[model samples]
Target: MFRTALRTVLAHKARLLMTVLAVMLGVAFVSGTLVFTDTLGNAFNKQSAKSYKDVAVSVTTYYSDDDGADGKKQEPGLSPKVLDEIGAVDGVASVTPRVDGFAGVADPDGKLIGNGWSNTGTNFAPGENGKDPAYDFTEGTGPTEAGQVALDKDTASRGEYKVGGPVRVATNGPVKEYTLSGIFTTEDGAVNAGGSLVLFEPSVAQKLFLKPGYFQMANVTATPGASDTKIRGEIESLVPRDAEVQTGKQLADQQAADIERELSGINQMLLAFAAIALFVGIFLISNTFTMLVAQRTKELALLRAVGASRRQVKRSVMAEALIVGLVASTIGFVLGVGLAVGLRSAMGQFGAKVPAGPLMITPVAVAAAFGVGVVITLIAAWLPARRAAKIPPVAAMSSVHAVATMKSLVLRNSIGAVLTLIGAAGIIAGASMGKDGKFSIGAGAFFSLVGIIVLIPLLSRPIIALVQPLLNRLYGVAGKLAGQNAVRNPRRTGATASALAIGLTLVTGLTTVGVTLGTAIDKATTDNIKADYMITMAGGVGGLDESAVKALEKAPGVSAVSPQRASYLVIDGKDSSASAVTPGDIEQLLTLKTETGSLDSLSGDAIAV
Candidate 1:
């Protein structure tokens, strides 16, 4: 049976070409997604590990969005005294104070270096080795005074500033000029995404950021041969109640987990699209198998006449499908790995910075690709195999072509009609319920698609008849013969058209949804946004400082300014969100329409609808 199946497959390679491609393309989608996501996760993990490897323990202040008991926002910062106390601990080797802020670096032509969204600044606090652990300087040294600044390698290259040349810099405050003291490289995501990086002296950073005598956070390294747990415990006592103290290993693990969590949403979205591709491929594979079975009706009947059992014939057909699936899956997996490489390179070219790391191929990805390819192919071929097994042995010597009987056609159309009606009703009910009927809508779409595919045989006759007159007018006798051949085998006509219909419908629906959403978003933006300039941190990493707000308010040519902070809370035992904004002046920046309540008397504790 196996030899016979192999021989059959070898004889009709051209006939099975579409089936192989359908399986291969579906598997490729899944393999590509898995490979790209694996490489992404691995690169981030390696970058996090390298950044923290030298540390024994690390301390970072806990970030919060809530206000204090006094209804005033409790700003997060660490005093210099805390770093002093940590440095004096028994196992402490050194303490590095970190102060991060926003600094916009300008090109030599005096234009912003980034997209005018945000840039990053940090204090370059070098230790006894005259080097900051977080950065490696390629030229000169870390900034030493207010007049000097070190720039990241990309920033320096872009702004045309050498080690000794002046670089124009700006914060939320006034623009400042300073000589470039050094150039360095880093693994920071923001800087890699084309944001300028500015390095300042410890005191200078505090002064510019307006956080006097305090660091945003501190990192402590344990002395050689010291215990990380013991060092962490010693340092934890010196920090504030909301501050976090972690060992080096803990910090690396936490960073990796955070990255993975952020990537999960994107991975799921990619997987959903992959599944859709696989679903579409099923129709193509099944249709091809059905056509192949019909073409081989005499061959299958001859096998039965030669004493081949029904089960053996069915198994033989499946074996052919199995071989095709295995070969296609292998090719798909290889192409998927190449796709991952291309994806990473493409992202880099587009300025979405990710750490440069070797490609990662996990065992799960391999198993998943093959499993999906083989199973989907086998499922699509099952119906065709059953039909082939039912071919009569007498037909081996008969000249008449085998076709579906009147009774069978009636049965098939009845089932198709019932399913189509049910699906149409479900779609109507789901559409009426809006967002609350997501599950119903999805189920309705699935049923409708399946029903349409099944009813293709009956549906094709009417559609072909409609175009029959036009075909006769255009091509006369040849077109008339083609229509007669199509009408004679409704099953074959339906099978051939089902794949094209499924693909076309998906493309059309997606395009329509995309255009509608884009139009709605444009309308919403035009209606609400009234500000001349909207200041925002890249990726919403931080919010404006009180001093930064005051500077913007006082800057020349600025009329009105409003800053809004977003917070999530468990209000009345359910998760809800609130936006805190300045009173009344918010109207100056945005068009506000009140549904119920007024905003004129809005204060610290006031809520507006």
Candidate 2:
């Protein structure tokens, strides 16, 4: 049976190849997307894991009340008592604490450098934090005193500093001098990238930052042989309400989960695209199967007449489909791995860090691809199978290319058309109800697209008739034959057109949405930004102070300078930012358009106007 199937496929080698390629492409897309998803997910996990190693808990403090109830102007970090309590736990191994402070370091000659910090008062200190207190110096010893500092490799190398070299260090309070004592690097090298280093003692950082008794984190390491789960449970129970405890693995998982959640919508869109490709492939497969079965109907009928039962005939055809599907799916899976690599690389260009590795192809993926291929084949071969099974030997012997004549259903067809029209009318009526009802532009557009797809077949005859004259004029013989060919099998023609139209409709609708949204935003921004010269800060909101505005006014390009203040406000639990301009002479500076009243008469209540 397998040999027979192979022979049959070989006989129509070209057609078989085309069908197989179609199936392969669809399967490849599915495989590639799956691989990309897993690869990116793992990469993110690895990066996050490197950052949060051996850290059992973290605390981030923010103002939680309406009033400044606490007289302590600067909020205290995790107290020394909290650290001691965590360290005193039976399962706890050690506690390392470090104060958070901002400081600046300069080279031996006191040259201000971008790599190191300057004039920032550090306020935090580390006391018995479980993190390794000893520094892994790249060149010299850890900080010995307040005036002694250690620089990371980046700062040390960039500044041409060595051990015992004089490096000017300053905090927010005043400039302080320090000698370079030692340099070190973190395990992941992030410390160096951040252009900072640690002072071994809490007092040193406190002096540099101009604040005392404050720390960012109390990194707690588990005792040897301690299970992370147990440690996490113990730590969570003891940690303050504002603090959060998570195992290293849990933190990595959380990061991956967050990224996955963020990209879920994008993945859904990609899957939809893959499904569309599969759909396109299904049509091609169906066309091939229809042609194949039509060509071989006589052979099938003759076999049936001799000895073959309906069951045998059905099994034989399905077996052939399975063989074809297997071959196509295998080829597709291999190609898909390659496609995944390319997709990963493309995403990397867009700033995703996907490392090279074996693709995470699971059994489920293979099963899914094979299943889809088989299902598509069966659907494609369905009509042909029915026709082959029903044809009598005499009828089959009459003509090899025989097509079943669809019995005329003028009334039934008319009824279907009427029903479709009714459905469309209902949609239109619902849309007319507006905001009071559930109708929307999106719903209307969706229904319109679907209605067009459904009614295109009924409408195709007329549409083609209108185009036939033009086609006839363009190509004398081929055009006439094409017109006849299209109308000869209305159902087949309609099916083909419908399949192609799906892709076209998607493209058209997406284009319309893109254009409409783009135009709306562009028009809105253009109308809002009526400034001749908008002087703004270099980065982020609340940029460019009043002093900067004054300086800009002193510049030669000084025209009328309008300072706009933009600030975010939360109203009714929704956040909105308002860009406020000083209300000046409304008539001189700008002309405003109003739907209800003149801008000259507008009050503060109509500021959004």
Candidate 3:
């Protein structure tokens, strides 16, 4: 049986190649999406482990409300008192209150520099050596004074800043001169999320950050063998309800989950395209099987005449399909792994942190790929295989075109005309519906489309019918042959048209929806952002001091500007954000749909209407 299957596939090299290509593409897509998701998950896990050491509890201030008019609670800076409260909790060993601020690091020459990018001053606990795990000291020592700084090895290497070298740094504050004390690298040092760290003592950090009595975050370390559950409860009791408390492991898991949810839709879209490719492959295989059976008609009859049961003959053809499916799947799986690796490398260049883990080929992925191959093969070969088994010895010598007589135009007319009319009605009705009616009305429209797809075989006869008269008038030899080709196999013509129609349906739907959605977002952005131009502080999502806003106001735009204050806004368990602006600036940039009060008159009231 194995030799017979091999011979059969080898006999038709072109058909086998086409089938393998299609299966390879589908498997590659599945492999890429799975690997991409796994990569992100592993990267986050490894990064979190290397960046933080045993951080059991953290409490940080966040915005309580979203009223942009009030700037009171907008800028979320952790106060030192909050740190003291957390440290006072039972089971707490020591509290290291850190004031983190990001600034672009320039070499002494001040040409190329590091962009100051930080994670909005999220807290990290002290490591085993009473230092933050995020920054590794490679040069002189950690920051001990206001003007001294520590630099990551990557940033220091890139800019040629070495130990004891005087480096000038620019931030919202004065352009301070600091000696590069040390260079360090984290375990996952591919990216410096905390930016080029010019760390300072807590007092210096407070002064540089422009927070008089506040700290950005505090890293809490519990006593050895302390119960985290009890420590968490005691910490929560000290901090306000609005403050965020999360363990290191919990944050890492949440980050991974967040990335997965974002990529879920993208994977679905890729799967849809892969399915289309597989669908097309099914047609090609079916055509190949049909031709093979047609040529083997006499051979099948001989087998039957030689006392071979119909069941035995059917099994042989099916066993051949099984063999092809298995071999193709194995080859496709190997190709898919290579494709996934290429895709991951390309994405990495664009700064996507893929998880560094071996490709996890789950049993489900293997099962799905093999199952798809088997199912497509079985369905494609079913009709031809059945016909081969049913061929009688006397009918073995029938003419090649004998099957054509059994198909007629009468049956097509009865079903074709009705479906065409119904499809036309659906398209018309669907087009008539307004925006509000589109959802409900579109369902009926989709049903109509289904009808059109089903009746393409019948409806296509009309196109053939039209082509015949035109062809008969247009040419003598070619036209007659073309007309005969169209009219001879109504089912085959319809099947081909239906397949094309499915592909176009997906294409047209996606294009239309993409354009419509893009237009909608553009309109929304235009309507909401009423400013002629925006003048933001140097750091908007990151903390920006007043000096940065002053520089923006001096820019050539020469327009009035607004200062923005933002904080983490956890509304109903979803992390949305809120920004604070002056009431007058809010009136200019944002079009307020007020429920109670005017935007111009917003004052001490918590609710901005």
Candidate 4:
């Protein structure tokens, strides 16, 4: 049976090729996502470990209710005074206070040289050994004066900034010019995640980059022979209540875990697309197998007459699917590795600083790719295989039958109509249920699509008949013959057209929803906002400081400016956001349509809602 199945597969290679391609595409997506995530996660893990190599313990400020306007929790800076206490702890070898902030330098063409993923900043103090463990200078020395700055080697080369050359650096404070004192390389020697780093004197960094009297974090090294656990304990005892102390390994592990969590979300998103592709492939596989079984009707009946059991016939069909799936999955896995590398390069261009690392393909990824492909193909072919086994031996001598009976057609159309009504009702119910109705809507859509596909044989005849005249007029003999042939085998024509129609339906539905949603947003924005212009930071990290607001207000030709701060909050067990605006400017900057209360009633301590 297996040999016969293999021969059949080999003989129908051209027909089976389409099935192979469909499985390959889906398996490629699954394998590519797994490889990409594994590679990226490994790189981030290495970076996290290297980042904390020198620090035995870290002391940082903790935030409780510090969710910022952008819905992200803001890391509050620790008071520099806490550094003295941490340094005085027993087992603490050395304490280095670090001040970190975003800083960008322009290239010769005035293009910003850093990306959102890149961390560009200056360290406030060198390590106890009089060297910064994070950086090593490739040329000249670290910055020693307020007017001098040291840039990472990559940034220097990319921006065409040489030693002693004047460079402009932009920070939250203001843009300042400094002499390029040195070009340095970080511990990993790659732009920290595609970001740039600039070093400056402690005083200069504190004054120009960081908030006054605040440090981002303090790195504490343990004394020689001191355990990090003991050092962490000692620091924790001395550190202020607002600050949290963690061992270096704990910090590194936490960073790695965070990156993995984020990557997991991306992995799921990619796998969703893979699932859709595979779902569509199921129809193609089932349809192709059905057609193959029909073509081999006589051959299957003859085998049964020759004493082959029904089980053997079914097994043969399954064996054919198994071979196709195995071969296609193996090829897909290899193509997926290349796809992963391509995706990495594309991500890099978009400023995802994935560290250079070898592509990682795990055993689980390979197993999953093959397992999913084989399982899906076997499941899709199961019904068709059963039909092949049920073929009567007496029918082998009779003529082939291709048309459906009137009774079967009526029954199919009735079932399809009922299913379509049920599906439509479910869709309406799901839509009315709001955000929690995703599953309902998805189920509804599935049923609706299946129902529509089932009814296609009945629907296609009329649709084809209506278009037959046009097709005939357009192409004469070829068009008329094509139309007649299409209406002849309703099942085959319906199956082929349903596959394409399903994909188009989904695409059109999504596009319609997207356009409608976009238009609604535009209308809302125009109706709500009364401001002439709004200034926003490119990255929604830190908002514009008061100085920036004042500067904007003082700009010539600017009539008025308002600073609005928004923050995320848990309201009535639901995640929501609130915004703060100046009371006086609220009416001027916004068109508030009050139902019960006037906008003028809003005060510093009172909220409209």
Candidate numbers sorted by TM-score from highest down: 4, 1, 3, 2
Candidate 4 Cα outliers beyond 4 Å, as residue runs? 63-85, 88-90, 109-111, 115-120, 187-191, 208-214, 401-414, 427-446, 475-481, 565-588, 594-609
lDDT of each: 0.83, 0.63, 0.64, 0.81
2: Cα error in model 1, Å: 2.2
Give candidate 2's error at residue 196 in angstroms.
12
How would you encode candidate 1's per-residue C-alpha lDDT over 1-609 as one tens digit per residue? Answer: 999999988998998888878878778878888999899999989988988888888777754567867787755678877778888999888888888777888777877776544488889888888898889889999998879999989888878889998877776556678988999988766686668789998888988764678787777777778999998887878887678888889989998998899888877887787787777777777877887787787888888888999899899999998998998899888888888788888887766677888888899999999999999989989988888887778864583435678999899988888888888888888889999877778788878878888899999899999999999999999999989899988887887788788778889999999999999998998899988888765345456557777888899998888888897678789988888888867988899887777888798777775
Q: Model 1 off-target regions past 4 Å?
A: 63-76, 107-118, 192-194, 399-402, 405-411, 430-446, 529-609
What are the RMSDs of all candidates, in order? Answer: 3.8, 7.0, 6.3, 4.6
Candidate with more favorable, higher TM-score: 1 or 2: 1
Off by more than 4 A, model 2: 1-4, 63-76, 79-213, 225-240, 355-358, 400-423, 434-458, 532-609
What is the lDDT for 293 in model 4?
88
Candidate 4 C-alpha lDDT tens digits along 129-248: 667766788898888888898998878987999999999987766667999988888754237566678898887777655556667678888888889998787777665456778889
- Model 4 scores a C-alpha lDDT of 0.81
Each model's TM-score, in the order given? Answer: 0.87, 0.73, 0.74, 0.87
Candidate 4 vs. true structure, TM-score: 0.87
Residue range with the least summed lDDT across 10 consecutive positions in model 3: 115-124
Candidate 2, residues 1-609, lDDT tens digits: the string is 456556777788787786798788878877777766776666656666766776655434332333344543434455667677878876677676655445555555654433333222222222344223434556766664667766766567757877897776544334456777677654332242234454534676643332365454566667777777776677667655555666667766787788788667766776787788888777677667667777787777777779877666666666666778888888888887788778876864542334435567777667776777667767766665565566667777877445645443354356556655665665667678776545544555555555555555566788889999999999999998998878776656765776788788779978998999999997986776565665432222124446665676688965556566766678899988876665553333454656775555446666653
lDDT of 3 by residue, 332-351 (tens): 66776676678767865654
Error of 3 at 79 (Å): 5.4
